[model samples]
Target chain A: MEQDLSAPGILTSQLDQAIGWARKYSIFQYPFVTACCGMEFMSVACSHYDIDRFGAGFPRFSPRQADVLMVVGTISHKIAPVLRRIYDQMAAPKWVVAFGVCTCTGGFYDNYATVQGIDTILPVDLYIPGCPPRPETVLEGLMLLQKKIQAQGRRA
Target chain B: MDLAPILSDIEALCGAPLSARGAGSDTVLTVPPAKARAAVEFLKAKHGFNVLVDLTCVDYQGFGKGTQNVSPAPEGRRFKLVYRLMALDAGTGLIKARLALDSWVDGESVPATIKDLFPAADWLEREVWDMFGVRFADRPDVKRILMYPEFTGHPLRKDYPIKKRQPLIGPADASARERLSPADLRPRIVE
Candidate 1:
C-alpha cells in the first residue's frame, strides 16, 4: 500500500532486511582445505549434497573475492602465518567457519605443531563439530551462517 | 640377498662398525661420531647404498622410563642419530639392500654433515636439527624445515614440553600487524 500510488509494482520492505536477504543468498565461499576434513568438504559440494540450492555452489579460490572462509582441516603452527595472511587478504564482510573438530579445538593433536584452534588467529563465525563433520552437518552450518548474515546485517 | 650376510661382511665393506648388531631382521651399525660420515660414504661407493631414506635423532633423556623406541643410547651418549640408507637395483627397480647407521650424538659434539655423500641428506639433516636441536658441522646452510624460524626449541626432544606452541601470529603474540581479525567481530560460540 505504501508504494501503491507513487511506485506501482514496487514491493515494500525494510532497507536493512532487503539488503540482508540479498546478501545472505549469494554467498561467495573460499575453501581453505589443509588436511583430511577436505574429503567431507568435497562430498558436500558434490551432486548429492547440492550446496547450489543455498546459493553457495560456486567456490571463489581467491581470498579477496570470497565472503566465507571455510577452514576445513588442521592448522599447524608452521602454517599459522600463512593462514593469518590469507585471512588478512580477504575483504571485510567476511566470515570464517571452522568445519571440523581439529579446527574447532585442535582435535586430538594438542601438541607442538598444531594451533590449538583457528579462532585464536581469525574471527570465526561458525564451528561445525565432528571429526570431519557429515555433509548434513555442513548444510546445517551453512544455513546457520545464512541466519547470522540476516540477523547481524554484516557489511553490505 | 637377505642382507644378513652383509652384516657379517660389514668389516670387509666399510671397516668394523663400533658395534654391529641386528635390530629385528635388519642390521644396525653403531659408529663413533668421527667415523659416521666415512661409513656412509663406504656404503655408497662399494655397496650401492645410495639412497638416504631417512636421517633422524633420538634423545634418550629418560630411556629407562619408556625404552620401546631404541635400545638405550650406546656408549652413554644421551642422543643417538640414526641414518637409514637404501639401495635399489636400477634395471629391476627393486630394493637391493637396506642398512641403518647409528652414531653417538651429544650436545658438545657436532656430527659431520653427509649431504655431499647423498644429495637427499640435505633436507633430512635439517629436519633432524629442527626436531632434535642437533646441528651438523660443514652443512652449507641450517634452517628449520618443518617449524618456523622463530621456533625456539627442538620440539621432539624429551625435555621439550609437548603443549608448547610458538605461533607467529595470534593472540599469543598479537601485534598491530598481526591483529588482522577485529576483536569485536570474534563470533560468540553458538550451541
Candidate 2:
C-alpha cells in the first residue's frame, strides 16, 4: 500500500487542474434571443467575431443540453413564464448571462409589458450591458464567464 | 378631385348628407352609426374605395373632461369607430369615415359591422372590441386580438390605469395558487 505518496499528490493536483482547464474552455451556449439584440448576437457568432475560438461555437437550442443560457433581448411579462421554464429545464452547473440592457434592466422598455430584469426570474451569473452589446464586449463577457467557471471548478 | 358629385350620390343612399372634411388629398366623411354600414358599402361598390386600409376605435373619455379646449363631441357620444378606405387606382386616393357610438354603460350594441362588405374588418373589429370594449353586432368571432384571453379591462381606454398590472401566474386553472390579490384570484372561483 506504500505506493509513492508524494508522486500521487502531485499527479492528483495536476489532473484536477487539467479537468478545470477543460471545463473552462468547453461551454455549450443556449441563446434565448427575442429581439433586435439577436442581430448583434449573430455578428458575434459569425465569421468576423467567430465565437468558436472560445469553444462556445456550438449553440444548443434545447435547454437540457446547454451549460450557459445567453438571454439576448427584451423579455416581456407574457414570455417570462416560458423563459423561467427554459431556465428550470437546463441541467445542473448551469450559468446565465444577461446579454443586453433589456435582459439586464429592461433597457428603454420601462413599461408594463417588459420585465424589469431577467435576474428577478433567473439567477444571472454575468451581465453584458449594452442596448445591444458590441461583439468585442460579448467576447470579453465570454472570457469572464470562463474565469468564473475555472474558479468554480477549483472550489468544487 | 371634387367629391361633391360622389357626396350627393352617398347622401341619396344614406338619406342624409355625410359631414365631410378635407385634409390634403384625403376626404373624411362623418356618418351616423345607423348609416355607417350602408355608407361604407356604397363607397366601396360605387366610388371604388376598394381597399380597407385600416379600421380602429377612439375613446373620447378625456376630450371634454379637463381645461383642454379641444373640440368635443355632443353630450352622450363617447366613442368613434374609424375606417380608412383607400382607392388604389391610378388617380383615386383615400377616404376616412367615422361612426360615433354612445358609451358602453347601458350595454348597447354598435348596430352594424362592415366585415361582410370587407373581409379585412374581421381582425380590425376584433382589435376595436379588445381595446375599447365596443361590441360589433352580428360578428361571430369577436374576441381579443392584441391582448391575451385572460386579460381584463380594455387597455386603450382613456380611463384605464397605466400602471395596472395583470401578471398571470402558472396555468389558467392554477389561479388558486396565486396569493397576490383576492380580485386576481376571483376569476378562478367558478361559482
Candidate 3:
C-alpha cells in the first residue's frame, strides 16, 4: 500500500442529507419542569415566545419519543429519582439542556435537598443561565442546537 | 368547632361511630385506621374538602410528656398522623384528620399508603417517612428521597444533632503535592 495519507476528511452527500433530515424534523422535548422555572418554560410554549419557530413545537409528555430533555427547574433530592426515571425513558441520541440557574446549578437552595446541578445524574449539552431564563434565551439555545447538529453532519 | 353536627352527618351515611377533636385550626376526625380511606372518601365526595394539602406525622415526645392530648396512649402512641385537606371549589372549607400513629400490631405502619386515592401522596408520604420515620406500608420506592442513599441520619427529627465537619475526602492540599520530590511523582521500579 502506498503512503499518501494527508487527505482532508470529506463530508459525503449522505452526511449532508442527514443534517437536512435533523433540521427538518421537530424536536420532541420532555420538559422536567418543577418549581418557579417550570412556569417560565410554560410561557415559552405559549403565544408570544412560540418555540415552534425553530422546529421545536410539540412538547412530548411521554419520554419514549422525545429527542431532548429540558430540565427547567431546581431538582431536589426528593424528586431526583423521578427525574432520572424520566431521563432514562427518553430515546437514544437524546440531548439535555439545563435551563435556568436552578437547573444548571442549584441557585439559592444550596441545602440538603437541592442538587447542585443536573449533570450529576444526566449528561448535559447546553447550560442556559438566568434566575429563570426568558423564552428568547431558550429559543437561542434551540438555534445553537441546530447549528451543532449541522456541524456534526453525522450522528455518533 | 361544630363536631356533633359533622359526626352525626357522617354516622347517618355510615353506621360506624366517628369522633372529632379540636387541634388548633384543624378539626381532626378520629376513625379506625382501617376505615381511614373510607372516611377520607366520604369527607371528599360528600362533605367537600377536595384538596389534599399535606399528610404528615408529628412525634409528640419533643413537645414534652402529657403536654398535648393529640396522643393519649403511652410509649409508641406518641406519634400523630395529620392529614390537612381543603375544599376545591366554592366552599373552600378546610378539614383535618388526626390518628394516633401508635401501632397495635407488630410490623405494622401508620397512615397506610394513601397512594391509591392520590398518587401525589407518594412524595408527601416519603417526606413524612424521611423526617418523622413514620412508616407507610406498600410505598413503591420507600428509600430516602431528600437525603442521599448512604446518609447516616434524618435531619428534621428533634433529637438529630446538627454539626459541620470536613468531608471524608477533604479538598486537595496543594502544599502536600509541592512537597513531593521529583522521584515521588514517578512510578517506582522494583529492582
State every prediction's TM-score relative to the real structure. Answer: 0.85, 0.78, 0.51
Clashing pairs in 1: none
Candidate 2: docking tier: incorrect
Error of 3 at B151 (Å): 6.3
**CAPRI class of candidate 3:** incorrect
lDDT by residue for model 2 (A3-111), tens: 7766658876776677668877888999999999999999999989999999998899999999899899998777888999999999887889888878776677755
lDDT, model 3, position A28: 83
Model 3 Cα lDDT, one tens digit per residue, A1-156: 595544543446566767656753567888888878888888898777988877787889899988888898888765777888888888776778888877665666655456666666666777777778777777777776666656545562
DockQ of each: 0.31, 0.09, 0.05
Q: What digit string (tens of lDDT, one per residue) describes model 3 on residues B1-191? A: 33455567665655666556664445566555565666667766765656677777665554644655453534555556667666556543333432221222112355567767777778887877776677677764687766666565555655555332111222212122212233422211111
Could you give the DockQ of candidate 1?
0.31
Q: Is candidate 2 or candidate 3 better by lDDT?
A: 2
- Model 2 lDDT tens row, B82-164: 77776566454434332221222212556488889899898898988888788888965678887777788887787778766
A39-150: candidate 1 lDDT, tens digit per residue: 9999998889989899888899999999888899999988888888898899988888998878877777878888777878777888887788889888888888888888
Scored against the true structure, residue A151 in model 2 reaches a CA lDDT of: 65
Give the Cα error of residue B170 in candidate 3, in Å: 18
Q: Global lDDT for candidate 1?
A: 0.79
Tell me the deviation in Å of residue A44 in model 3: 0.6
TM-score of 2: 0.78
lDDT values, one for every candidate: 0.79, 0.73, 0.63
Candidate 1, which segments miss by more than 4 Å at Cα?
A1-13, A154-156, B2-5, B12-18, B23-25, B66-71, B173-191
